[model samples]
Target: MAELYSRRSFLAGALTAGMLSTSAGYFFTRRNKIQLTLATGADPTGGRQLLVSMWNRLNPNVQIQVREVNSSTQDQFLKFNETHADIFNLDVIHIPRFAAEGKIVPIELENDISLVAPVRRVCERTGTDQLWAVPFNSDVGMMFRRVTDKRADAPVTLKSVLAASATGPVTFAGQLDTVGRQTDEAFVCNVLEHALAQDEAILDEGGVLSYGLGQWRDALAPLADAIRRKRVVAAAGEDDTARAFQRDSLRYMRNWPVRYLPLDRAERARPDTAEIRIDRLPLGILGGQSLAVAADSDYRDEAVRAIHFLTDNPAQKLLTSFGFAPTSVDAYIDADLQEALPHLSLVRYAVEGSRPRPIHANYAEFARRFADHTRRHLHDGEELTQQFITDIRSVLR
Candidate 1:
């Protein structure tokens, strides 16, 4: 459970960035020089120095620097708004807020704009018809398997998780503290999608409220029951889950693969422990990241170039090399890359079926309401589900 902050409070914090570094030089340059700063997630090999190197190689006159922001920071929007940065690696849901505030520039996604249709559709759903961002490093939740569990079988649904728990230990990142954070948010999104899949209308034609209470109730009941019954252990952290999996104490777990990258197979095995396996987040649901330009940037043209270079097939393939699932629709079909990453099909399904987080101007507020409600139900013994839906509706409204 990362510390929660109200949307208003986060906005207020934007007024407190006098400590941020000032622009190195005026935007005016002799040779079309554009100074761009990119705010990226905390992944060391992701959207970091590599993007700067690649962009510089493609556009020598452009100066782009990468700034690392702790993914857990609720005040990330504030930092984006206050920075001298011209570009950003923003989340899809958070983009609306910055766009609504006139702090982000909408991108002009030309030159085969369809490269990332799923990302584009998400912006359209948010009523941001103009491209508000570019695709940086993209990702999706992947299902992992312990190598020893050679049953040659893997569970791929809510029902499977519940059933697996009955036979052996299942661990999940269940701490309420991790709820509002992006990884945890993705976890919850999967839960919501699993619930919505049971209903035909998952999301309305307008892509607003989902209206299938009965199915949602049924879909989530097993998860709640498992948590309450001690058949499943809720880890306070992802590391805890990883540790348990390493000890052969965990038969199954759900989280992004980045957490597992730091561990080698030998360290993860207890003599007979087989290598862990990777697959996309369960079908019918997916979650990941997108890159957007700051509305306030004076360097939109140059920013667009940088965005393009980063998301194009060549760069996307480069990202794949770094363990990030490429967002490009075509990358999944690349024979060589697919061979290198055997789970490309699963990743493709997760990204294609993926839905962005609620893309409202007040997204943080909505996230808070949803997180609180989920925490109450999953942890506090709040057995009521429909009432929780009502509470969410009130806040969202």
Candidate 2:
């Protein structure tokens, strides 16, 4: 039966001689368990813990294993393409890059596990939405505050944040992580640029790309100035954003809901220090992760079932319970969760209204240049305001 199935897959893909031998041993057996390897930058053991519990309850026979992938570097999980995995949990920004490379299979969404609009963009961007992966979680950006600094009346907009954080450091990720490619950085950079553009602070309607480029530079100007002025310092990824604020260095921080779940878990696990505070990615744009299935997986039937059970309301609620926002439009409106997680409203608003970075295939190339420009202008005083415009034009062209 294994040989027969292998032959079918080979015929479907027209596997070369070497590839044929590679997949020869691929099939389910009583002794071997079906494996689903998911890649994520932030270790989602808490979320996985809940899913595993539910998965065990639903199907005791099929086994699912979650591998903590350092997506920033792409060293650990990149090989999954050579030997297909059942499912992939991918960073939204990385989707376009992955899709462009044809490394992923198209998703045929099954059951109640419908793909969210934002996540659908991943498929749309990759042109593999219907074929590869089902949208898993719709993560959005959230603003983190120190437990003691929470004033009943706090600033929520970027403009106000700048004013209040003028004298202190506002936090954000400095170094790109495993998944921190150009696309990922663009999500953060573009969000700020989008807001600044709307305020007439950056970008113009000519669509010259120069105008947009100018806005991006201008948008980052204040934040860069803030950092130079000792008002903003790069926080340690999303995980440290919350704690960095607690240390009195960061008065304001922007991060994803997933990064802070561990902080929340720590709060529950040990209530010693202080309660972490969260809000949306500051009335700007946000990004998230989605789930996709291997186009070549034999367990498509079971894979679809697992996806459905993992993304619905019950699963989303479980996510919310762990301090991560749900992608479901309903979860965005859930008053209880909103009250529990102050950032929930922000995430919902961002998701409904947030814009992703340029969906072009060249985004990865663009991101590399953008980050270099940011470092040069923000760190090295390389006159990025004008040079940025020229460089982006060079890349876009």
Candidate 3:
């Protein structure tokens, strides 16, 4: 992760000015300047803003504006029903759904920097030979442990992980409340990871579920224990979970890359604690955002140009300087850029090996089913059935 102090120096001077050398042939003159909108979540690192500002200056005729996108994944999907903006920044998991619905159009997303394989895979529509989006950043789930813990690694089984923490089993406290009433992506990702671990073919590209009935009990035993024990911290969301993890006397946390900053700081202030990362999990879930052109937009070609600028080599490096994981494999090649992220090695491990959550047009619904069913079975002790797997296919539309 890029420390705040390091980010300031890394983005200090030439980083903003270096783009003045972009080819003039690709941009129109200032007199022909036109505006385009980019919808993306707000980044605390301010890297997103920097990339846009740089693009505007170099390609004055193709000036871009940033629109603060909705934080809710469902809300973002709804906005995609029509051309909400010229450029849509989508969570990688949503790409398949949005592309299938024609909310985002297919474009041969070319990149000057070769993106990581896992990152590249999410940009594509499942079961198709077409690319629908360009990866903007990369994320992967990891198990964090306190250095004081006797277990040097993540516990072998789900049960062992629950008891690893000193303060009850709040270890997996992130989104524990998503049990009964579903719709939480974190909870869904957790269930999907375990299922994938059991059998890679459990879910097909069309969103069909086909694992053994016993797989449900085996896959969600930990969730059941968490509910019965009521040991999970009641975190409202991801940010709240991070804060709660910092405050709780817990030994393990499952979260994304950006967590290193806050966790590291918390450990620094605590006299008896230090954090270490267990990046190599049995399987890690892919998490990140991608850029796509809106299907209804009149400026499809122009939007594609904006996508190129935002994901170009320099912009990716600038995002790296601000602590965002680079989707581009080339970002790691720069020695200075590597220094900005102290946890680059682990980040590499997680990103390269991470697997996407089940791909479906109605992916959010698919996520809800897994989250809802897991909670249902745990609450009522309902065993998985062949009908249950059959019903999972209903989410295809």
Candidate 2 per-residue C-alpha lDDT over 9-127 given as tens digits, one digit per residue, 9 for 90 to 100: 34323312322233222223345466555444454445645565556444545666665554452232354444456677765655655666766656565444444465455455344
Using TM-score, rank the candidates from best to worst: 3, 1, 2
- All candidates' TM-scores? 0.79, 0.72, 0.84
Model 1 Cα lDDT, one tens digit per residue, 117-183? 5656655424544666666555555556665656775555545666667666554433223434544
Runs with alpha carbons beyond 4 Å of true place in candidate 3? 1-4, 11-14, 17-26, 125-130, 148-160, 163-172, 179-183, 195-209, 231-236, 275-278, 379-387
TM-score of 2: 0.72
Which sections of candidate 1 miss by over 4 Å?
Answer: 1-34, 57-60, 71-74, 113-116, 125-129, 149-152, 171-187, 193-207, 211-215, 236-240, 247-249, 257-270, 281-285, 385-387
What are the Cα lDDT values of the candidates?
0.57, 0.53, 0.67
The number of clashing residue pairs in model 1 is: 13
lDDT of 3 by residue, 172-283 (tens): 5555445332237776665666555555565443334565677655666655666566665645456766767667766666677766654675575676664554454556
**How high is the lDDT of residue 53 in model 1?**
63
**Considering only N, C-alpha and C atoms within 3 Å, which residue pairs clash in candidate 3?**
33-61
- lDDT ranking from best to worst? 3, 1, 2
Write the number of the candidate with greater lDDT, choosing between 2 and 3: 3
